[model samples]
Target: MPSHPNYSNQGNKFAPAKTSLREAGDLYGQKEFHIYQNAIEKMRAHDDQLPSLPIITLEIRKATSNPNVNLNHLSSLIAKDPSLTAILMKHASSVFYRTADKPKNLQDVIKRLGMGAIESLTLSHSIKSLFVLRNHQLKALYKQAWQRQTLKACMSYHLAKTLHFPNPEDAIVASLLSEVGTLALLSSLQDYAAPAAPTYKILCQHYSKHLGAILLAKWGVSPVFVDVLRKTGAWTLDTGRLLQLVDVINLGLFHTIHYLQPQNDLIPLQEIAAFKKLNPQYAMIKQQKLLIIEENISHILQLQKNFE
Candidate 1:
């Protein structure tokens, strides 16, 4: 297990809370850990339906050393899936790309945006397209999930540039797919009846443990991404510069939403602290940066509408 330089000595205080959440036992008075163990067993039995996509282990293996393969080859791979191609074209014509004219075809769009951006677009679209959940409740859940993911994708690109990460584009792709395990679980909720109007926190707490491991196994996601998702909530001096940027972007979006609508969920104070620590200049740069990113994302969404 290759650990990030900043991850050392960061004790897992959240681990115990995770235990209690998973166990559904006395939570406070359980003499032994067996009650919690039994609860985990039951949850495991219910969590059988993983994402239906085949594991692209070959892609993962190739990605580490030579991520910059030929664009035509990459485009061909993405074009095999119509939904993903639509998503890529939409993103390419989006405000992020800033082309004067909308692209007329997938090849044109891929040529315009370049391979790095295409990679992120393909990964984001593929995960969303893979697990089709049709229930009204599940649809709402996925909508929120997509919103969070889109926000993260925008923020990751901005943060990567700010932190001077080696591959800002790759950072965006990583951020986009960071919570895929959640999607895998949500895809299978039809198999069980979950309570209505679930909070993001509750849903994550309920399924993260098992789902995280399962997604890593089934999707062939890189170990680096898995590690980042596992420790996303933690704050430390060494949480990797790129991950720190991710944390700040997530917090910035939360605060931005909260300020716009007071009724929105309260932003965590620790998140604010982490954001401030990671980017001391965030206060100075946020408004302009956010405007640019949101405009791009909106453009992408608009393009998607035109296609529909």
Candidate 2:
């Protein structure tokens, strides 16, 4: 039989031996686990200074609720952070929106682009800055990871819009932040390595429950958004159309990054199946999903180069 190009002949060095979910739970139950708990607690205790500029949360809520919110106010808020303001300007000129004649000022950028576009650009900028890698290898790993995240954000945004959701911008923001817990854990855990590490997989598997609890206690993420991310695995559309879209986008993006194969002995098929059933649109386009993933990766890499 011809060997599959995508399959590696190397034995699964990253795989963990058979362990029941209950056993995994017991691992966390050990006394040593409190080390991580304490670390998370300490990190959370530090006040999360709002980045030098206003975040998307403030801009979106004001724009959506108050039609009278002017471009000047939004512009001034963004201008407070030079880095974010630069990102917004670059995005405004990117081919994605076809504003090649780059807007001269924040007000021009806001007036020319709708709130949704501005919000997405802001989200991309914010997420890119959250985690910084010191080593080249880890830097590449995080670059790829962020590419996957950006794709998820784009897919979620489009999915919500297609589903006629009221707050597609919020969905984009949620999808962008959903994996923040995972990033947080990776950033704090010095022993963890990336690209191919069983420990990394284990960390991700437990992150939702672990980080969700920590974020709830430490970060003041809205209770509603937290609930949406926590219940995402259950396929609960009742949370609202935007969240449902976020759930499916996350599933698709994750499977794409993992090559639709189980990693470190973690079987993600069930999660993928649940998401497909809940969002039939993702299922129907499964064949073309890889194309979207590749395009997103290419785009993000280009963006990263510009920043460097």
Please give the CA lDDT of all the candidate structures.
0.50, 0.51
Q: What digit string (tens of lDDT, one per residue) describes model 1 on residues 1-308?
A: 22221111011211112223344433334433333334434545654455544344235224423557665665566666677677667667666566678888767886786655665555655566667777777676666665655555555565565566666666555655556655655665544444333222334455544565566656666676666566554443355444454465444344334333434333444444445554444434343233434444554344335222
TM-score of 2: 0.61
In every candidate, how many clashes are there? 1, 0
> Clashing residue pairs, candidate 2?
none
Residue-level lDDT of model 2, residues 1-308, one tens digit each, is 11111111111322234445676577557655555545544544552521222355456545634667777677777777788777667756655445557688888777665776676566546656766656565566465556555555555554455555676656655665565555555455433334234334444564434553464445455565565465544432344433354465455444334542334333344434434444454344343343334445455344434333
TM-score to true structure, per model: 0.65, 0.61
RMSD of each: 7.6, 8.1
Off by over 4 Å in 2: 1-66, 99-102, 116-120, 131-144, 162-164, 190-196, 216-219, 222-224, 233-243, 258-283, 286-308
Query: How far out, in Å, is residue 54 in model 1?
Result: 4.6
